[model samples]
Target chain A: MDSKLTTTHPMVTADSQSVSSQEEIVLSVQHVKKKIGKKWIIKDVTFEVKAGEIFGFLGPNGAGKTTTIRMLVNLIRPTEGTINICGYDVTKQPEKALAYVGSIVENPEMYPYLTGWENLEHFARMQPGVDEKRIQEVTEIVRLDERIHDKVSKYSLGMRQRLGIAQALLGRPKLLILDEPTNGLDPKGIRDMRIFIRELASQGMAVFVSSHLLSEIQLLCDRVAIVGRGSVIAVGGVTELVEDTQHLVIWELEPQAQGEQILQSIPSIQVLDLESSNLDNDTAASLRPHSIITATPEEYISTTIATLVQAGIQIHNVRKLSPTLEQLFLGVTEGEFIE
Target chain B: MNSIWPLVQNETIKIIKKKRFYVVLLVLLVLVPMFTYAQMRQAQENRTKFGEDWRVELQQAITDNQNSLGSDRVPEEWKKYRRVFVQQMQYYLENDVNPNEPGGVTFTREFLDNSSSLFIPLLIMTIASDLVSAERTGGTIKMLLTRPIRRWKVLLSKLITLTMFVSLIVVSTFIISYVISGAAFGYSGFNIPVFTGFQPGDTGTDMSSVHAIAQWQFILMQMGLIWFVGLTVGLLAFMVSVLVRSTAASIVIMMAALIAGTILTNMAASWSTAKYLFMVNLGLTNYLSGSPAPIEGMTLPFSLGVLAVWALASVIVSFAVFTKRDVLN
Candidate 1:
C-alpha cells in the first residue's frame, strides 16, 4: 500500500501550483436541506469542490444528487442552509454568484429547431463577457465547428451532449456542474467526454460531475463523495475509498469438505462454505475445491497453512484478492441499486 | 438590465427563425387578396344598383339608419350604432367626400379599422401565445434559466420580442391590404379629408366636435391606434403564455377570450360589467374612426384606460409568476 501510494502521490505533486490552489474552493455546499411539501429530499448535504479537480458525486437512485445540483444552480432554492459558488451565496445573490458558473442539468436540452450555432449564439448573449471569439473558442474546444451550422435536431445524442458542453463552457465558468454528462453515450463518446473533462480541469476549472457509473467515476474523478439516502456516506480520494484494511485469502485444497471441517475447528480462522448447488455437473466435476479463510490479526497465513497441512489436507494454491471499486461501492451502499 | 438588449435580440432572432412570422405574412397574402376581391365585387354591385350617385347613396344610408332608429323593437345598442351610422353618412354627404370611394388609401383605411377588432388580435395572439410557453415546451427554458441573467429579464425580453412582432404583423397587414386593394382600387386618395373626434352624444356632422384630417393623417393615426390595441392583445397573450405551460393551451385560452369578447360586445351589452373587459375595449381604432363603442359609456379615454390597466396588470402578474415559479421539467 505504501509503495502504491509513493508511485501515485507524485502525480499530485507534479501539478504543484494546482495542488496549492486547491485551497481555493470553487463550490461550498454546507448543511443544505430541501423539503418538498412533507418529505425531505436532501438532508444536511455538505461537500466542497475545489479548483482544478474533477469532483465526482456518486449516489444510488433517489439519493438526491440531482436535487442538490439543482439547488446549486439556483433552479430550486434550498429549504435550509446555504450553497456558495465562487464565494457568493447562491440563495442570496444568485445572479452574481452564478455569473461564473455554467451548468447542464440532466439532458442537454437545446432548442432542437435552432441550428447549433444559433443555440450557442442565443445562450452566449445571455451571459456577459461572452463574445464571438469566446463562442468560437468554446465551439472549437467541444469539436463542434464542422457541425455547428447544422440544426441541433439533426445532431446525434453524442453531438448534442458536446454542444451542451460547449454552451456551458461559453462563459469560461470557474465551476462547471454537469449532471450525468456521459449519459447515453457510446464507449468512444464516453472516452472522449472523459478526456474533455480532464482537459477542462487541467485549465484550472473545478468540475462537479454527478454520476452513478462507479467505474467511470473511479477512472475519471480525483476525489469522490458516495451519497446514500440523501446523505454523504463517504468522502475521500478514489484510491483511499477503495483501499481495503483487511485482506481476503483464498486457499484451494484437495477434498475441500475435509479442509472446511479442519478450518472450522480452528478458533482463529473462519471458514466460508462453497455452495456447489449452483454449479453445473460438468463444471463441478472439473473444478478445484476452494474455501475462503479469514485470518485473524493474531494469526498469520502461514499458521493457517500449517494447520491445514497438519490436518492431512493437501493445499494446491493460495491467493489474495485486492478490493475493487465495485466491491467497495457495494460495501458502502450495502448493495443497493446505484441507478 | 443592461444585458437585456442581447436577450431581446436573441429572442427576436428565435422568433424570426421559427418561420411563424412568415405564416402571418402568408395568411395575409392569401386572405387579404380574397377579401379585397370580394370588396371590389361588392363595390361594382353598388355602382350598378345605385347608378354611381354619391349624394344619393349617402342620403339613402342615412335614411335607412334613421328608419332603424325609429323602430320600437330595435335594441339600445343597435340604436346607438344606427345613430353613429346616420351621423357618419350626414358627414360624408356634407363634406362631399365619398366614404365608399374605390381608392387604395380609402379601402386600406376602412379595411384596417374593420379588421382591427378581430383579425389583428388573432394574428397578434398567434405570435404572443407561444412566447414563453413554447420555450417551456421546447426544453429551451432549461438552457435559458440556467444562465446568469435574472428571470424577469428573460420574460421582459420575450415581452419586447412579442411587441416587435406585433408591430411587424400590424404594419405588414396594412401594407398588404393597401398593395392588394390598390391593384383593384387605384391609389389616389392621399389628400381626401376625413372627419374624426366625434364624441358619443355629438352628431357625426357636428363640426364643433369633429375635425377634418387628411387621408394620410387618418391612416397614420388609425395605424397608431390599432398598434396600441394589437399590443394590448399581445400582452394579454403573453400573460397567458407565462401562466400556462403549454403553447396550445395559451393560444386557445387567449383566442377563446378574444372571440368571446366580440360575441359579448355584440350580444351582451346589457351586462354593464362587460364594458370593463379588456376585449370589450380592444377596438381602440373605433375611437379614431368615431365609431360607436361596443358598449355604451366607453369613451376613447375610458377604453384606453381599461386597456392600459389590462396591459399593465398582465405584465405585473407575468413578471411575478415567472420570476418565482420553479422550472420543473
Candidate 2:
C-alpha cells in the first residue's frame, strides 16, 4: 500500500518533532492563538498531521477544535500563529494552500435548494483542476450515488453527512479534516465510515478527525492530539497514550473504610479515591460502594492484602483493572490525577 | 476575477431554484394587468369627452391645464406643475404632434417613469437583500467561503450576479408593461412624434430646446435611466445583505429606506441638502420628460453622480467587511 511506504522509511523530522516515520507533513499548526472579542478562545495550539496517517483531535466542549478547523480552511483567521497546509500558509495564501485541503466544520452546510450533485459541482468549480469526473468519483466514494440527484433539503442527516464528505473529497485534497465524523451515523454506518476513512488514509491522505468518541479514536487513529482549554495538552500514538498512565487495581472488602485507611497508612501502598477522582463516570460508578482502588503492583499487593486482613478486613473481591482510553481521556483533560 | 462567471452561474441557479426570480416575475404578472386596465379606463373616459380625435383631446387637455394655472385655489407647487404642462401642451399642439396618444409604447414609458422610485427598486431589493444574508441564515456561508478562492472574488461574483438580475428585472418590467397594456391600449404608437427637452423652471418651459423624437426612442432612454436606478438600489441592498445576518431583516431595512426615499422626494423640496440623497434623485426619468426636479438643482448629471457615489461606497464597505470579518459561528 502507499501508506506502507511512508512507515518503512523512518526519518528524523524537523522541529514539530512528530513520529519517526518519514511521510511528509501535510498540516502543521505552530503556536496558533485566536482571541475573540476580549476573550482568548484558542490560547496556544500546535500539532502536525503527516501524510498517510489518521490523526484524532480529542477535546471536550469549548476546547477550540472547531475554531482550529475553521482556521485550517481559512474561514477564520488565527490571531497569532502560522498554519501551513501542504506548503503554503492558509491565511496568507488560501487559494494555494486550501487547494490541498477539504474540511467540514460544524455541519456540512450545503445549499438546501441544490441537489447533492449540484452542491458538489458548485464546490468543484472553485478549485483549479476539479472536473465533472472528480465530482462523480467523490459521489461514488461516499456511496451517495443513489441519492446524489435529490435536493439536499430532502436528505436525512446521515445522507447529508455522506454528501458533505463527498464534496470535501471533490478536490482530491491531501488533507481531510472532519469534525465529529461519525456524529449522526447508525452503528452500521459508523463501521462503514471507519473503513472508508482507513481506505482514504491507505491512499496517502492525512485524515484529521475531531471526535468525542474515545473508543472510535482508539480503534481508528494512528496518533492523537488531546486538547484542553484551548491548547494541545498531549500528542502521541493511541496505544502509547493509554500505556503512559499509572496502573491501578480494584479491591472489594467488608469494612471498606478500615481497609482503605489501613492501606493508606502503609508505606508501600497508594490508595486512589474512587468518588471524587472522576476518572470516568461509568468507571467510577461500576465499582461497589465498599470497594477501594490501589495503584500498588500485583507482587506487592499481596503484603497489603495480608495487612488489611490482619486489620479485620474481610476480602470479598480483588481484580486488576486495565486502563482504557476513556479513563485516559478523563484523566488527561481534567488533570491527569492518576499521575 | 477570471472565474467569476462560474460563481455567478452558481448564484443564479441557486436563486432560480429557490424560486426568488419566479416570485419577482409573478408579482409583475399580477400587477401589470391591473395597471393596464386602469390606463384603458382613463383612455375610455377621455374618448367620450373629446369624441374620436386625439387632436381634439390634446386641445382640451391643454385648455384645462391652462385654466388650472390661472386659478388662485391651486397651490404654488400645483400651479407650477400645471404651468409647465400647459406650456409643453401648447408646443405639441403648435408642432402638430400628440404627446399622450393611447398606445403600448406610451403605456410602458408612463409605467417606468412612475415606478422608478418605489416599485422597481422594491423588486430589485427582494433579490439583492437575500443574496448574501440567505446563505448566512442557512449556515451555508461556511461552505461558500471555504472554497479555494479569494474572498473578494466570491463577493465580486455575487455583485456581478446582482447586476445581471437587476438588468433582467428592469428590462422585463418594460416588456411586461408594454406587452400586457398593448392588448388594451392598441399597439400603434412606436413611431409617433414625442416632445421632450422642455426643461421645467428654465425660461418658463422653454420651447427653444423642445424637440420632437420618436416615442420608441424616448422609451429606450427611459428604460436605460430606470435600469441605473435599479442597479444602484441593488448595490445598496447587497451591502445591507452582507452586513446583516438575517435575510428577512435585510429586506425590511432596504424596504424602509426605499419607502423613505419616495416620501422624501415628495416633501423634501425645501430641505435643499436632500438633493444629494440617492432616493430624492431617483426621478432620473423626469429629466427625460422635463418634469421639475424634486429639489431645485437636481439635474440628470447631478442625480447620476449621487447614485454613482452611493453605489461605489456600498461596494467598498461590502468588500471590506466581507473579507475581513471572521465567521464566528
Candidate 3:
C-alpha cells in the first residue's frame, strides 16, 4: 500500500538533533537467527511491534522463546541477522540500542541482601534523569510502595516480580520486554498484571510479552506471533487467525420411525450419529440425529436446514457454530481437530 | 570519572562493613605485641644469663683471646663468624648501647625488623590472596559489571582499595609495635643506624660488613619490597579469578604457586633458574639483611625484575580476557 511508503521514524536520533515527524515503530527484529553447538536455537524470526502495541509471543516448552529474547537484548550475539531497538542496531551499537529497552529474560535476579529501594537507586543511577523521584514513581507504579524499603531476600515471589517490573520501568524505557511476567502469579495477580500491561501500552510504551498461556495472550495482546520449533508459524491479529478456520453446521431432527429414511433421502447430508430416540404415545415419537454438514456459514444456514425440512423430517433446531480461536489455534498449530 | 568515585567509595564502604576485616586487624594487633614481648623476653634472658657486665666480658674475651695467641689463632670459619659478631658487639658498645637492653623503642624497632621475615609476610599473604577472589565468591562481581562502567575500571578500583589496606597494614604494624614496645623498652632507636652490606660470600672478612643505614630507612625499604611482592600475588590471584569463575580455585592456585616457590628455593638451589620464581623474589629484604639467600646468586635488581615481569603478565591477561569475554548464562 502507498501508506507503507510513509517516512518511518529512526529508532535512535543523533544527540541534540530533533526530527520534524516521528513514526511509532519502536522495535524491529529482522530475520534473527541463533545456533548453539550446531543446533539452531532460533531461526529466521522477523517481527515488529509499533509504539503502544502489546505483542505476544506464544510457544511451548523449549520452543526458543528464551533464546530469542536473549538475542533481542544483545545479551547473546545472534549468529545472523539484525535487530534495531529505538533506531540503533543491536549488534553494532548495542549500548545505544539497549538504552531504549529494558528486559527480564529469565528469573528476576537482584541483590538479595540489599533493600528494594537501594537496588532501585543503584540501577537508576545507571540511567539518565533517573533520580529519587523516578525511583519512587516506578516503585509506586509496580505496587511495591509498602515493601520498597525491605530487603529483597524477605520479599515473596509476587513481591519480587513486582520489584522486577519496577526495576524495568525505572529508566522509562520506550520498549519493555518481559518473559513470562505472570508465570508465578495467582489469578488476582495475573489480572493485575494484565491491567498493568494494558496501562503501559496505553501510555505509548511497546510491550513484548512472552507466555505459553493462550488465554493470557488472547486477553492481553493486540497481536500475537505463534512460535513452533524455533520458527514463527503464524503472526497476525488474534481474531483474524481464529476466524480463518472452516465452519461446521449441525441439525437436530426428530421422529424415531423415519430418521433413517430421511438421512438416506438427503444425499448431501452426512449423518454423524443418532443422538437419542424416545417414544411417547401421548405427544410424539421422537429421534434426534446429530448431523454434521460441511458448508459455509451462510450456505449452511440456508441450504442445510431447507434440505432437511424438505425431506419430511421434523427439523426442530439448526445452528451454525463458528470455530473458536482456541480450536483454530490448535488446528493450525497442531493440525488436528476434536470430533 | 563520576562512576569511578562512587565505585571506589562503595569498595571502601564494603571493606569497612565486613566484620572479618576488623578481625584481621585485631589479629594483627594482638600478634604484633605478642611477638614483641617474646623478643623482649629473649633479650632479658640474655642479660640475666650472660650477666649484667656482659659487655665487659665480651671486650675482655676479644682482647684476652688475641693476646694469649699469635695473630692467626682462630680457624678460618670460626674466625670469620666471630670476627663479624665481635665487630657488631664493639659497634654497639662504642655507642654506649647494651644490645641486650630490652626496654626501649630501639628494641621494638629491632624486634619488628626480625619478625618481618615471617610474621608480617604471612599476614600480608592472608589478606592479599583473597582480595579479588572474595568478590567473585560473593556474587558481587556481576552486580559490579552491570554498572555503566567498563570492567577494567572495576578491577582498578579493587586494586586501589587493596593498596590502601596494604599501606594501612604496614604502617599500623610500625605504630602499634613502636608504641606498645616503647612502653617497656623506651623509644630511643628511632635514629639508630643499621648496617646494610654483609653479604654471605662477599669476602671472608670484608671491611664494609657494617655499612650503616638509618634504622627507619631500612624498615621502610623492607616494607616497600614486601608490599611489592604482596601486590604481585594479589594481582596474579585476580587474573586467576578472571579465568576460573570459582573463588576457591583461584586462591588454591595462587597459594600453591607461593608454596612451590618456597620449596623450589630450598630443593632446587642447584638449578639457578629457580631464582626466577615468585617465592624467591618475595624475600627482597634478604638481600638487604645480608642473610644467606634461599636461592643463591639472587640480586636485588634481578628479584625486582622477575617480580615486575610476573605482575605485568598477570595484568595483561586480566585486561585482555575480562573485557572481551561474553557474559552468557
Q: What is the TM-score of each candidate against the true structure?
A: 0.84, 0.89, 0.71
Q: What DockQ values do the models have?
A: 0.52, 0.67, 0.14
Query: Which model, 1 or 2, shows the larger lDDT?
Result: 2
Question: Top model by TM-score, which number?
Answer: 2
- Score candidate 1 by TM-score against the native: 0.84
Q: What lDDT score goes with residue B219 in model 2? A: 87
What digit string (tens of lDDT, one per residue) describes model 3 on residues A263-327? 44555544443221111222123323344333244434576556656767787666555553344
CA lDDT scores, all candidates in order: 0.80, 0.83, 0.67
Candidate number with the higher lDDT (1 or 3): 1
Report the lDDT tens digits of candidate 2 across residue range A1-339.
Answer: 121211112222233235343567888888889999998989878877898999999877677889888888898899998888877788998888888888888888898888999988888877778888888888888889999999999999889988999988988888999999888789988999899999999998999999876678887999888776788777778777766554577888777777777878977667877653335567677888777887665467788778877878899988766655445655455555233
If both were scored by DockQ, which would come out higher, candidate 1 or candidate 3?
Answer: 1
lDDT of 3: 0.67
Give the range where candidate 3 chain B is weakest over 10 consecutive residues by summed lDDT.
B139-148
Which residue runs of candidate 2 sit more than 4 Å off their true CA positions? A1-22, A246-275, A279-339, B59-74
**Candidate 2 residue lDDT tens string, B1-329:** 25688898888888898899889999999999999988889889988998888889888888888888788898777777778888877787888777777888888889998998889999998899989998899888888888788999999999998999999999899889888988888877889888888788755877678788888899889889989999999999999999999988999888888878888877887899988878888888989888888788888999999999999999999999999999977
**Residue A203 in candidate 1, Cα distance off native in Å:** 2.7
Q: What is the Å distance of residue A135 in model 3 from its true position?
A: 3.2
On the 0 to 100 scale, the lDDT of residue B285 in model 3 is: 73
Flag regions of model 1 displaced more than 4 Å: A1-20, A244-330, A333-339, B66-76, B201-208
For model 1, how does the per-residue alpha-carbon lDDT over A196-304 read when each residue is reduced to its tens digit? Answer: 9999999899999999766678789988887777877667777666653334456677787787777677776655443512222343465454544443323367887
Model 2, docking class: medium
